[model samples]
Target: MTAKEPSVFRQGFKDGLPIGIGYFSVAFSFGIAAVSSGISWWQAVLISFTNLTSSGQFAGIGLIASFASYIEMALTEFVINMRYTLMGISLSQKLSPAFKMPFKLTLGHCNTDEIFAVAMSRQGEVSPAYMGGLSILPYVGWTGGTLAGAVLGNILPFSLSQALGIMIYGMFMAIIIPAARRERPVLFVVLTSVIISCIIYFVPAFSFITSGFSIIICAVAASALAAWLHPVEGEVADET
Candidate 1:
């Protein structure tokens, strides 16, 4: 690659490298979990590449392993990860208006939170191709770590494995930490989730709804409350 290309690529890599380091442990947990659930290493890796989402990947693996129907799988994942649709729209404005379908088809698969945050932070045009490279490396790394973890997990004791699994929750908590600091509504939503999760855990009758459904319900409810409490800025209607 050209020196200029490397310079152009450095920003996305810098943005994603920390995520890559974090994914080593977290994705390793996913890999081991996938293996423990009887999925193969290659399958786990493929899912990581295609899904590029932690919650959605876990849900898909659970449903796939459980022999969930296509409709069930689709609906569960769609509800859980519908945030990507909104995120995509927001990210699209960063791209040139001429961003074509082929580029979208190739790189759209890797539009995760880290990529979006990094891409949006840049002041000028972030070459989509360079961003794709930055995104792809971590994707492979996350999947690779998982595959390695799955293979190693087969030999490790259950206690050690569970301890290692805490990394995934820790990574999520890291995401929540920054958001909570920046946005009051985010903190409120998190608190709301905590309350709802307690209710879900304690209330026995509602157990029929899966984690996927719970996520959908909570997001919808939290969004409604956030909107009601904090209406869009400057949205007062002007009367003629």
Candidate 2:
């Protein structure tokens, strides 16, 4: 509302543009996966619109397809998305003091990994106007792409629909690789997490564990290890 606030908002929008573009393809993949897994197109859109979390939504769709119990779905969603709580806490510190509880609630609803990263990369306190701007485009891209992809999933060739499912993983790699390349600690954490995940996935002993639990174990173990080996000063951080 201040005269200078518009510029902050504009900068946030500019920063979030790439994330919005990236979300389209990833959400496209989710839409395909959701529909292929037997959900209706509009249902898939509703999931994306309400949740806006890639891992959480994918896990929910899987559980839904399997006809898992409500408790099962609830646990999976909590384990997969508990990291968002930390992300919200971290981003909260970076916000300008004027960003009150109401603004925090609004901004927190749409805080994804990329949005958090973009907001943190800035040098100063993040503004509420800026956070609002940052959330807009990605929200549109995610909801819009899900709707589009769900419609397309109905008509696309089976082979093509299957192929599109991998785009979400590609988007994840795009986010991780650059940071891994720049930081040894990050690279170590990623590799450790992957190795642990593979073990839990393939080993007979852990085969009994559900996918959600496996992810929770691998993530927490690798992150704890990383924190022990390479801690960041002035903040407690965990890799999700």
Candidate 3:
């Protein structure tokens, strides 16, 4: 008899394991940062649970700590997370017939960067079951790690908690450095964003710009510059 093939859900779960593990470490740092920023441990965990995007959450907590306005927070989050909208559009093409509107709405919450990459890399149409399985572990790991870190932040010495908070920066660098090395466009965009951010933060002329607006400006300006400099070679497909 032939060996049985793994179920699609099982396959997705297996593929998501590494991503889940990675999320735990990064989310731990986020948890520490959140608590250190003056939020309660439960609040930190709640942020992680509700907003799965790492960068957005980090920026958001900073804004929260600085007592930014609701509009600033909303705009900043919308700008940072706009990529997910694009990712959702791309994945729409690959959804199986069984992946209906309700499933799409539910799973869209879990359509994170890593998850999007994994889903896009798969062969043929992706099923709802597979997406469900892929999301479970990462969600748990992120939330669980935040809970662990937030609680530990209360118990650990202040210096140590501050040190642990730096891990998230390292994680972002690790992610960006490799891709930036491989692609000139990536490098250019990264450098441009960094420069713009520095200018906004350090230049007295731009001192009036709040942290939240500064982030929005950097992201939009860098991305717009990159697109102008290196436009992708594709025609806009018309939706009939």
Query: Which candidate's lDDT is highest?
Result: 2
Q: Compose the digit string of candidate 3's lDDT tens values, residues 1-240.
A: 013223888889997787787788778888888999999999999999999988899999999999999998998888777767766888887887778889988887999888887877677777888898899889998999899888875676777656755654564576678868987887999999999999899999999886656766887799889989987444322121
Model 1, 1-240: lDDT tens digits are: 345666666666666776676666667778877977878988888888677777788888888889999998888888777767766876776675435788788787787766665665556555665676568667876877777877776676777767866765665676777877887877887888777866776799988877756765776677678778866454221111
The ten-residue window of minimal lDDT in model 2 covers 231-240
C-alpha local distance difference test of each model:
0.72, 0.82, 0.81
User: Model 2 segments beyond 4 Å from truth?
Assistant: 1-4, 36-38, 154-164, 235-240
Residue pairs in candidate 1 whose N, alpha carbon or C atoms collide under 3 angstroms: none
What's the TM-score of every candidate structure?
A: 0.73, 0.79, 0.68
Instruction: Estimate candidate 1's alpha-carbon lDDT, on a 0 to 1 scale.
Output: 0.72
Rank the models by lDDT, top first. 2, 3, 1
Question: Which residue pairs does candidate 2 place in steric collision?
Answer: none
Across 1-240, the per-residue lDDT of candidate 2 in tens digits comes to 489899989888887777787788788878888999999999999999999888899889989999999998888888777777766777877878788989877787888878887777666778898989888889998988888888875676778767756665665687779889988998998999899989988899888876656766776788889989898866433221
Better of 2 and 3 by TM-score: 2
TM-score of 2: 0.79
Which model, 1 or 3, shows the larger lDDT?
Answer: 3
Which 10 consecutive residues of model 1 have the lowest summed lDDT? 231-240
